[model samples]
Target: MELSVVVVNYNVRYFLEQCLVSVFAAIKGIEGEVWVVDNASTDGSVEMVKLKFPQVKLISNQTNLGFSKANNQAIKLAKGRYTLLLNPDTVVQEDTFRECINFMDTHPDAGGLTVKMIDGKGRYLPESKRGFPSPWASFCKIFGLTSLFPKSKLFAHYYLGHLDKNATHEIEIMPGAFMFLRSEVLKQVGLLDEQFFMYGEDIDLSYRILQHGYKNYYYPKCQIIHYKGESTKKGSLNYVIVFYKAMILFAQKHFSKQKQNHFVTMIKLAVAIRATASIIKRLIIKVWLPVTDFALMFLGAYLLIPWWEQFRHGVTNIYPRDILYALIGFYLLTWIMSLWLYGAYDKPQNLKSGAKGILYGTIAILVVYSILPQNFRFSRAIILILSAWSSLSITLNRILASTFIEGLLKWNARKKSVCFIGTASELKGSEELLIQAGFHRNNITHLLPEEVLDEHQRAKKEIIADAIKYKNISEIIFGTEGIPMTSIIHAMMYLSEFDIDFKIALHGGDSIVGSSSVEAQGELYTLEVIPLAKPVARRQKRIFDILSSALIIVLFPILWIFLVKPLMVFKSALQVFKGEKTWIGYNHPNISKQNSVLKPSVYLYSKWGKGLTSTVGLDFYYAQHFSITLEVSELIRNIFKTQD
Candidate 1:
């Protein structure tokens, strides 16, 4: 065979289908063969390939063996003079293969090549060509100097930004997304280093191609659209750590003896920086806005006292900031805890979540105030004023922070003007679903499939540009059957100049869904996180349940006489020991297993043992928003809000 195409896929079946369709079209006249090596994807990618493209060779691994190893499996058996490692989340232009082959054929010294690439939004991806990550180049990139001076030779070498996109050039790196290499070159340079689980293996392979006397070229004659982050999200902490660790592996292998320490140090610093940024982002989104509520509550509590004294006792001896300040802090902390337990501060906030969170907080304050000694108590007049101020401030902050996030940057906001793009038929109930999912109903608009593909590329670009300018569409949703990946990619490329977000709506016929999660179809939205089923996470919950339940049994002595005997506490504990029940879990244990916020299915809650006394729908709430921090918050609530 003249050409062999190798695709490594992990759970992106829809994108893989579109990619194969484009690949089949690209390799038309040539003696070409395709190999798809699936990395044990549960997204039905293996089944799709077997059913739809059986002509292609398929290798199915039982577990994720990393990107390098998966590609090596297919590369070892490839029979073509040239092998192309293509990402599943990409659409190749019709001329991509032919142009690459012709260029390689003409350049007798070309060992490997990569064509120009664009992201889903259609802008040229700088990773299409790159210089080796020497210490200096890595530093510039890690510190973001490369982005600051894209066209400058000194700072922009990471992307080889010195080169023009319109011209072919001898570059140092070709992305794994579109690595077209000579079969003979593999015999000389060896395969991708399996030590790299995902990130730096491409850089390692590219450097080896150069070390072995083969030249790598960046050809811009044809392009493919890379639907970036479909396989792995760049925003994830795991991705960040793994990526930087890959850099360290590269530095150890390739850096000079004298400069190895420098490169290693740079890699470590980069990892630290990325990890810190990820943590800060999570803290701001999850805790920062809620903290403001606490601060305002304290302020309201302090100010209301003087206002009450002036009216009731006609004594304006203003209390010192220290007077009952500690108690006020404790009381407000309980209220905020109540907010967290009541499912307040959930992302993608709906109108009611904010109101309910504040309501819970107010009730908590009232409960605490009613039980306080005279020395600790503030007057009822002060309590009412504090409640009003705290409720209004917290509610307004939640609304403005979520909806007008960009304008204020005061809180974590995801308010977006969404453009639903699909065929008119496919879009029938999409609008209603999106509204229920908490997108602004008024901000939601439609962009038909015809408008994106009715004309040529130039015309499509014009139409999309005009729409983004006039309608201010911040997010673009692709409907299944309503929009093909190719069309979605095309729209992204055409609207590349515009700042917008792209998402694939998984509108499957599955009936499972959470409050704002997957139900009928599953949307693989951009950077959408899928919870990994780790047995350790479940074990932690078991440990916590066992410890907390034992403590409660011992501490609450009255429970031993009246409640423990009648309610069969020992029997429940036996069931828990036998794995039939959990100390804390869903309202029902034997229900269907669910794992996503998108559907109401057992998703996250099903992992734990069920509890004897459930706290409202907290199990289901945690099921929607799973995190160590949120888990701790739920545990705290279970301690205070117990029912026999």
Candidate 2:
């Protein structure tokens, strides 16, 4: 065989489907065999492969075998002269395989080859041509010197950034996303080291290939799109730890004793620093808005307290210091908590939720005001004024942040401008998919093949340029069915200068996948609607949980006379209240464990039957059509049957 393509997939079913589509297209007439090693993907990746690509060699692992072990599994079974370790999140061009094979055939000394890779956004990934991560290179990369001096040979040696990206060059390392290796080289040097689990296996193997007097080439002619970090989250502390730890393992396996120790220590230090930074960054992103909102609201209310005392009582500091501070603090806490529960901070630039949350909080504050002692009571008009201030201030804050801030808080409140490039049928299909995926369809523009192609059927650059100028298109989506992989690659390369987010829509699939940057996780917009995935639905469900749990706790005392296990009922309520469990959740442990959005339940049942399968069905039904009434009815039906 000419080539054997091995893709190790885990839970990225949609991406895997698109990747396989491209792979099959690329190897249309070639002597190539494809293998997919699915590492216990609960997202139906195995089933999808079985149904769609029956010709593929499939190995379904019962558990998640890390990157190295999984790739090794397929490499051992590969029969082709060349073995390509392909990521499930990547899309290869039609001429990619042919061009790569030709190159490998000509360059007999080439042990491995990797091509130029652009991210989902069509941004050239610098790691496509990297120097071997020596101590100085690693240090430069870890300490941000590589990024600071990107084109410098001394500091940017990690990525070999001074090298031209459009030309083929001999490189020391190949990215795991698209590593094309000669079968002979693999047989001589051995399969990927299972010790360096995820990140550094490519570096280790590349270094070994070099040591064995073979060259690794970075061929830029055959470009592919890598929607990076689909299988794993890149923005997590675990990613930092795993990546650096893999580097340390590589050091232990390959480096000399003194260099190994030095590398290990440096890696550990880098891990500690990066992990800590990740944690802090995450914490800031999570709480920055809420904290800022609280602080501003508190300041407004605090200032209002002194003004109210002066204006109404004709005396400054009339209220007691303890009561004054305590009341203000309590009121602010109540408002913030209510806003949080109502999901004001959930959606970016969603001022409507914040306004709704403020209104609800005002009502709550009034309710609490009526119940409090006369001495603790403050001005009702002051509360009204403070609420108005909060509403205005919060809205202004969001508008300013979204306008000025570059990342995280920067969100376009306006409908996104999308341009779909494909056939008429694919354009219509993509529109429907976009609507199902919750994209605004108002500003959508369709660029048909005929409109975008010349008399010779060559893609016209001015077509996209005109669309961007006229429509202010921010996102461009290409359909694989209507456009060839070669055309997609050409479009991406030509339009790389534009500020457009590029997404790929699989011809017959429900998902549109993209990533804004190389460091970002791949974003999938699919038709598989989980009701609980909505912020509003989640907020309502949480409200239902809290109110129902509180009522259950309150009624437990009265039910003690008729109940067989009154204490158990009380305990369940407590658990639900504390978020340790849920009143109505997924019945099956497996479904519940994999992004089910429901906590483990105190009771499991359905209107259908008492069987285990029935219970699991009920869970799916609940997730799809989650409503307060459904949960309440379920709670009522299964309240007495809790022991079951």
Candidate 3:
């Protein structure tokens, strides 16, 4: 074989599919075999390839052995003159593979080469080449000073930013995405060190290649898209912690004791400052504002209600002491119910904006007052006073809540990383769009096609496995064209099994419609929204349902017993008093006709300790007969009529 393409797969099946399709498309005439080493993907990735692409070789491991060990497994089995480690979430242009092969062939001294990388939006990734991570360089990176002083030679040296992008040059390290190596160079350097599971393995391999008297070239001619950091983005806190731990392992292996200590101290200091600032901000918003508002509302209600009563009633003390006590009790009960039903005391600093909270507070008060007996009722003036006070108080509370919560949400959002897999030009475009759309650059992790495991026969399987094992990929975005529909479907099936959200990039082709559907899991339905639809409406409906259900449950007992039950009982008593013995029947033209249609019945009942009284009522048999006739007539009319 001329070349071996190794890919370690985790759970990013859709992205892996697009990547493989692009690779196969690019290397159409090239002499090479693709190797996919699968690291125990629960997403059915192994099954997908077995069913779809039988030409490719696959090595399915029973467990997720780390990136280096798995890739090494495939490399040992590879029979190619050269090996390429490519990420499964990446895509290559038609000319990329041929160009890389020609460049490596011409430059015999070059042990490895990495192509220029771009993101889904067609912007160049900054992973073309990098310098060795020295103590000073690591410190500069940790402090973000390298980016701050990009034009300065001293600062730019850390990221190797001073290097020309138009020309190929020797560099200390090339990103793992497109690490192309000569089989001879690997023989001299030995296999990759499996000690570093993820982050440090590529660097260690590159270092060994150089130590064997070979140059590592950064070639910009060959281009590929790297969908960086797919595994870490899934909101798994453990993935983030593991990635950082891997970085520490890298530092410990390479850096001096003093440098390691310095990096550790800097990280500690940064975390301390961030935590301190957050705590102080939280105290000012959550504790101070809510307490102040509650006090203001209490004082305002006490003063306003008395003044309003004096103005309206003229003689405020006309009500007896017992009635006054009842009025006070009702006010307290209503206020307490409002607080509970309206979620008034729920960390006001975390509440949403708009009229939702205010509306709930108003409804709670109204429902409570409507339920209580008329003897316990306060003047309408008191209700008005409470309403105005509560509305203003809750609104003000939410405003403060919004300010604090929004800041916290933004802070949390900054920690999330997204990776795009496609061609370099495409990724560059994606990166630009994402930045314009408010994506933080620091959170983006690019996985270039070259970084995928090339020696592995099951490249897709290995790439997906590595993505899940090493990178904290929260989501995978496939950016490519002419990708096979079957492969896409296969990838989607695998991702669904893992509960991973995978999205395909729409590159202006025949639009894909009717692709969205819902999967029912018991009472919970997983609605797979098509990538094209705006997400706003779905989120809005969810909020509405949650709020409506909570309000109904909170008000059920009070509303049912006080208002609804009384109205129902009064309506029943009124029918009996009018000498309509039937509970539900029409009044007749003649008494005899009515008697023939509906017979009356009498019964006796007692109330509290009162004596029993006989009550006239409708006979069950005749009432049922008339009711059935009326219902049948209504059904006939409904069926025949065009309009209601």
Q: Say which candidate scores most in TM-score.
A: 2
lDDT computed for candidate 3 = 0.56
lDDT of each: 0.68, 0.82, 0.56
Estimated TM-score for each candidate: 0.70, 0.85, 0.52
Tens digit of per-residue lDDT, candidate 3, span 101-183: 89889998899999776544334566667877665676666567788986455776655887887678899887777788898
Clashing pairs in 2: none
Candidate 2 deviation (Cα RMSD) = 5.0
- What would the TM-score be for candidate 3 when compared with the true structure? 0.52
The total number of steric clashes, by the backbone 3 Å criterion, in model 1 comes to: 22
Q: In candidate 3, residue 414 scores what lDDT? A: 40
The predicted structure with the larger lDDT, 1 or 2, is 2
The clash number for model 2 is: 0
